[model samples]
Target chain A: MTMVAQTGANTGVQGNKTPDPAKRAASWRAVRRAAITIGLALATYELIARTGSFPRALLPTLPMIVRTLFAMLLDGSMLMHSLYTLYRVLFGFFLAMVVGIPLGILMARFRRVEQFFLPLVSALMPIPSFALVPLFMLWFGIGNLTTIIIVFYAATFPMIFNTWSGVRSVNPLWLRAAGAMGADEHKLFWKVIIPGASPFIITGMRQSFLRAWIAVVGAEMIAASNWGLGWVIFDAKEFLNADIMLASLAVIGFIGFAFERLVFGSLERNTVMRWGMMRSAKS
Target chain B: MPLIEVKDVSLAYDTPAGRVQGVLGATFNMEESEFLCLVGPSGCGKSTLLNIIAGFLTPTGGEILIGGKKVSGHGMDRGVVFQDFAQLFPWRTALGNVAFGLEMKGIGKEEREEIALQQLKLVKLEKFANSYPHHLSGGMQQRVAIARALAYNPAVLLMDEPFAALDAMTRDDMQRLLADVWKTTGKTIIYVTHNVAEAVYLADRVIVMTPHPGTVKAEIPITLPRPRDPLSVEFLDHQKQLLNYLGQGTSKAA
Candidate 1:
């Protein structure tokens, strides 16, 4: 009801406002260690580049990669490619959630739903999205449609399975308690079942998004989409632009990291952790 | 007429090990504003009988009637408190949990919150209304559960070993609190417990049950004064009498 204890919220704020010296010192040390590790790795790679083992075309220097990245960003090509990749992944991921969540709830609640879908889902889950890229291209043609479908296919399984497990694992005691308290079927599902199953549902979303991110890149590469990060990397390979390819790879990695940490992490904190259903590692 | 009637309720189910009779022809009638306790060892179906009264389960053969009407399923007339701490919805605060029944009955938010706060105050947990179930201790959580059950102003309260998980000291305190609440509300309570002392201390009448194909063994009326003393001679005599009934159960099996 949002009427959480004042002491709890106050303590949370106090913890951040007045961090103990020991914790501050420990955190600083971790930052220093990370910086040193990155510096050493980059120095080793620069040394190898100077020695020119294979060729500059095959293995560009760090500066060359950075220059290419900056050039792409300035010309707006990198942003456009990233936007395309983001759109496909988000679209497919949401579609999977819309279809998968209700389906999972149905499967958990009704035996007939499980019987009808279990075998089909089990059979399709093992098949990788990349394997279907060519088949989808032939059917739907090589474009956004094929890539989005592949992403949706890759993401839907985890969403459905995790949601099904979550609903099933909801404590039977809670269900009985709700029932005895005069909650009808509709109220019970919304008030008790959904909240109880939310921890698992959120976990499913996180896992499915990760799968969708991976599937989108692979699908884009194979389907030869003109605008995605995957397509840019694949296209750079043909022109022997090693720096451009590496730059695109870096963008993909950064976006994935941001979504995982910034988006999903905050979501977990706001819902499950706040509800006391889950504990945060840091807290 | 009795406020509640359990007319020869029998529940039998076919397990992989053949037929299992959970409760065989168990029957009882409870008066209005009476404090009744179902006492027995594990698997004696004391809890099962309580579930039947709460309408969580339907007896295979017989029926349970409340207020002269047969109970079809769970209803707002009877409120139930379970032993498990997980019974409270984790996402809701204590006030929210207490107000859940009222919400289901379509009460407005501000009014339900007012009623929930009053219930919490009755249980001496008004200050903790905003606390989540996980943040509360076992005793506190059980108190919140009690508050939640009582919030809807149900005609009857059915509790299944509600204080069994607490420490001895806390259990004693809860018993005293429960007696106070029962006196104030004057609602009929059918409590299930394994602790003989708890039954003797709190119940106006204790119904002792036995394990093998669980059935009611004896019903001993406790006529002790209000705020009954566990160390009192009369109370100890009552406990001893109940113990003998339970012993008869195991002895007959042997």
Candidate 2:
């Protein structure tokens, strides 16, 4: 929606030109540059593998890794592992969202809540989620329970921190204006406070998802479940199946990239971008 | 009863250094549909007084009555337009922001939008109803703020230097637009400003407040006709009187 005015202005400036052709050329330039960089990197890797500087079993060529990835997908084992991992991550992320958001809003609104939670969040935040994995494994036992808990632990802190600051940082002027317009406590929270604080809260969600993704992979590797991409990579390492390991790594990277671009990107486009609180990078 | 009556209202608050008196014994009365202005130098507490009457802040002493009822807290009857435009919600379209007060008043969605669009038309920005606040110019944004404040049909509108941020040409245009709106709406306006010329141009009566526990020094009635030229001799005389009143306060402080 924010782009509507800008789009009109651009078309007017271009006059007779369709606008799409020039825009398409600029995007094509970016794609060609990226393709050349990727091609060069792949060629270097293939050259190094051929020279045999390291064990071929330890460092599989890019073609071998791609083949392994295709084979696993055909057999459906990779899909199953991915589904199991997604289930754990989503569950843990959901739990974090449920707890962190309300807790943060409460902390911002009330002095007592802030006093109670601030010190606790600070002390606990410094301890990494992976450090808690060994302890959680001891407590919850290996498998889905430990993995999910670790993801939850990783995701919760950023959610709380961002939301707390978001609510606090709400423009005082808007709050005053709303109050002046007859907004009661309930109306103030819903109309002014929530929308005003939304940018920070959305940023917090993005961060929480990123943390959850990383935590799930690491926890799956250490907690070694029967089915997970991380587990497959670690298991493949023991058998010197470098190709399998590399394939899983590529899948992990692809999934992370997809969530970041497709999910959070669209979320941003719909909310803050439309609101004019944030502009998309190119525009 | 006068539309608004302020009887010896005062306010004090504590800062890190010590206690500060925001206002003291600020007394006045505004008749129905009266255009009143509070003018003084910085630290004069004119805005604080306006805030108190708006019921956004409680007076630590005395009382304020609106339509002869003692003001308790912010209500639907008294709408406030703030300096800095206090920002229209960036997410909401101009129509949505204007409709906000109606929404709080619990008007149905369609009905509120209808009223909001009408108010937008009043401000002459009807075409920008779908535009977000950021997309509009500063002057347009302030017009939307005014439309929003006026949407719920408040008896009196409280303004805190509403044109302070605009450029001189835009500010002048806004003042005339506001004066026209005031005539048609017939809403009692308690406008706060530091500009002496502005006080003479728009106000029916100027309450020249003295600083350091800001209180009204004198109330000068503007007998000048509407569409009164700011450059006219009579207008200049009124401006001179306001300047002297303000000068008395600062010179006394010195």
TM-scores for the candidates: 0.92, 0.92
Alpha-carbon lDDT of model 1:
0.88
**A-chain TM-score of every model:** 0.88, 0.88
Overall lDDT per candidate, in order of appearance: 0.88, 0.87
Worst 10 residues of 1 chain B by lDDT: B245-254
Candidate 2 stretches with Cα past 4 Å from truth are A1-27, A280-283, B248-254
* Best candidate according to DockQ: 1
Model 2 lDDT per residue over A83-105, tens place: 98999899999999999988889
Per-residue lDDT of model 1, residues A1-283, tens digit only? 0212221232232132137887677656766876899899989988998797879998899999999999999999999999999999999999999999989999999999999999999999999999999999999998888888999999998899889998999999888888888889999899988899998888888888888999999999989667999999898889899999999999999999788756866777777777788764353
RMSD of 1: 5.2
Q: Cα lDDT for residue A169, model 1?
A: 92
DockQ per model, Cα: 0.73, 0.65
Question: How much is A122 displaced in model 2, in angstroms?
Answer: 1.2
Identify the candidate with maximal lDDT: 1
